[model samples]
Target: MPHTENHATHREVELLETLRAQGGSARTSHLADVLSVSEETIRRTVKVLAKTGMVQRVHGGVYLSNTEALDPVGSRLKIRTKAKGQIAAVAASMIPSGSCVFLDVGSTTAHVATGLRSHRDLKVVTNGIHAAQALVDNNDNQVFLAGGALYHVEDGTFGPETIEFVERFNIDVAVISIDGFDCETGFLLSSAAEAALARAVTQRARRVLVVTDVTKFGQSAPLIACKPRDVTAVLIDKLPDRIFHQKLIEWEIEVVVVPDSKTGKTR
Candidate 1:
């Protein structure tokens, strides 16, 4: 069939338009059975839509891209303050004194930077403007900011230049945050440019630790930052479902579940 101006297959266009009208959430298996195709085909279709920013993939399905706007950093800091703080504390405790560390941009990572303030003679390199600022305010640690174009939404710097700078140095440890995690795709972030920079940092680090809240599990973002196998450890508030947990363990990924102290509960 001749391709239409939309540049999508007829089924793809049909699915997108239907999702646009009825909302993007749909069951892959149900769509497959309804369309008389395999579930893998449905997943592929959704991935394409997600990459093009036409849809946002949720835990069990996809959602309209515009359903919820990306929260600002300040708002995000408030939303998951306790969980993020605990994750940051756990991440900080893992780092040895006077080591070189790479911190990625994100509210959670900013918390980690705050936790690292008391550590002496630490060399901190980061792409996050907020993390650099926090380190500077502490005035006790050495901080290097990767220079590049600032992504306002993410409040971080990223580009080829920044990635090149990160590639030059070998880091003892790297603490990263992601928007999502999946057994098949590994850690996921919202932007391709950010993911590229993150991958560079991950490559240079001897030990890579991913710090994220449990809510990140099961979500799929546009870019796959790094595979679980690329990292040495994962620290999250809690594990999600049993099947996903088992999958990570099967892959030999060390999972650390941090409990919420206030509630004294595991999320």
Candidate 2:
């Protein structure tokens, strides 16, 4: 089966959500009951989710991967650091010093915020507390943080208030992050709140730039961030396969592959 088409099925999401509600781990039989499915069915879904690094299967049960836990900010920051930094460098270069920018709570977007630390006089809007902290105080920049419920899992804020605050800005560029992207889904996020904010900014911003590493290329997430038509560019650490590359062309999305610093050549 094609990965994109089969990614994050409704059953899989239900299973994961149930596991989370059960405190991030559960017995296989219990999961089968909660999802109202057979034990074999639960095993099959767990196997698939495990392959995607979303879960871990043990003797007779499964648990959410540390990277998939409710509070995953630290674990996420430790993953693909080099690739994320390279992509962030490319994304930061695209923004001028005095432009209005929208950033998000994803780990990759946190790296992008770091890259922008040196840029002065930026008008920034973001839900990531870390993102806002990174860009403030170094320069005469203005940062508006979305207030409401704090999403401790990703260490960000989101709610109707977050969405309304984001809609208030006419952003020059919205630099967001994603959990997955493919020809079929365009861009995907694991958090519904983050996805809502992404959608709001993509509509209001003049440009929407997605900052993610190559690992997300073939994966899937529960929420759709935006379609390819809404994105202005994608900054990544490496090139995607030929099929996905062609899809980017078809969608008229700009692909910015950050060069490998070791060789100083585009990967």
Candidate 3:
């Protein structure tokens, strides 16, 4: 007998093939219209694809998954140090004194950890080894490391173990870093394991803030970490285009465009 085919899986495969043919970007609404399902359903399916590394979620749609590998963590750290530093400073300012916060593991989140080192009586729970190292070096605040499988590329820990640890604590805020964001996909990450951790952290926090640079906009990653509607705020280096800005407003997500003090530029 021939192998049975699941219609949902079949549709998803068809969608991926379509995305590959279209140069890697498609509007969510358009895809929904074509698929004859609700946009929410389409979005959820896309998130699964992102987690599996088969497709990248870009602004307004998804991208043909990239085959080019990312650079070493150390190299990436040097490339975006300044922008990440500024983003970290802004993210740190959002935390109230003496609050419990969850910090994601990434260069930008590491910057936030550095910026927050001086704040007194703050409790920080993190999975990033670099972030924990930064806090340990400063020795001014309380820091807890969520132990799990370490992914060298992110210089942090993730997996089921980390998810369990995060669930045990309720955080006042979560500052997450994203590989990219589009009005459609909200927040994207490079790995499915990282995206799982992000989703778990977002659920455990009272307020979730996505901290990223301007380059994140219009770009897509293989994993969808969160929907644009799930976040409370988006802190970026520049404002996105008017259309995307309006879409975010419609979703009730507050967009904070922080000017780059060094260059005095706005998105």
Candidate 4:
């Protein structure tokens, strides 16, 4: 049977997810058995994935190449879908139409772009391809994509040129996403290049909004994206712990918790 582009892509994503679950490397035979496909099929899927620099082939298995950076946006969109949707909705509510917004390359930010579709006019600046694609063709919105080296793994532009491109815009609100958070660190991201870009956007924007899920709490990342004082507000799916909550109060950062959709109450 011939594999259509969509079907092959779906199989590739499933294999990658399985690899992540198995600690970023898996035997070809094991992957074949788990995915209920032939070893030849697994090899073919991995061949396509490897060409994109997403995976590396070994003697009898494959390993993910970029473990340091955040997962690809496609894989991340599948994670915490409900939580991200709620956060995106709350984030959209904060920004009025015709606002100049800066959205970063985070998966949650992509969802926020979707939420902004109903607005009449929006000036959207972003490095994330996903966010730009979502908001490009709706309600007279203008999307400015930062130009620089494109990182295919994260599906966003980065480097010094990207930063310079964003600096040209006067951002009304900057919506960011974090990989981890803590009282001391404030917000965290896995990539240093991305962290620098986030810092630049935060400095340029009048209001800085960090959108993330509660799972990031207590986790740690190498680079601190921004301090708590730099943030205007945070939109999350659930409440943070006591100590973290207290710190947000001290920093005067507004905390907006999206209620659980099923229960209509914040957790």
Question: What tens digits encode model 4's per-residue C-alpha lDDT throughout 1-267?
Answer: 212212124577678767866768999999999999999999999998787556799999998775644467888888888999989998999999999999998889999999999986899999999999998878999999999999876799999999999999999999999866767657876565788798888977999999987777766544568767679999988889988888888899999999888899987
- lDDT: which is higher, 2 or 4? 4
lDDT of 2: 0.82
- The lDDT values for all models are 0.75, 0.82, 0.73, 0.83
Model 4 scores what on Cα lDDT?
A: 0.83
Q: Per-residue lDDT tens digits of candidate 3, residues 23-139? A: 456888888887788888878888887875557787768765653224445556676677778777878888987888888876777888888887877788999877777776454
- Which of the two, 3 or 4, has more TM-score? 4
The candidates, ranked best first by TM-score, are: 2, 1, 4, 3
Task: Name the top TM-score candidate.
Answer: 2
Model 4 stretches with alpha carbons more than 4 Å out: 1-69
Quote the RMSD, in angstroms, for model 4.
11.5
- In order of listing, the candidates' clash counts read 0, 0, 5, 0
Clashing pairs in 1: none
Cα RMSD, model 3: 9.3
In model 3, the clashing pairs are 24-63, 24-64, 59-182, 238-267, 239-267
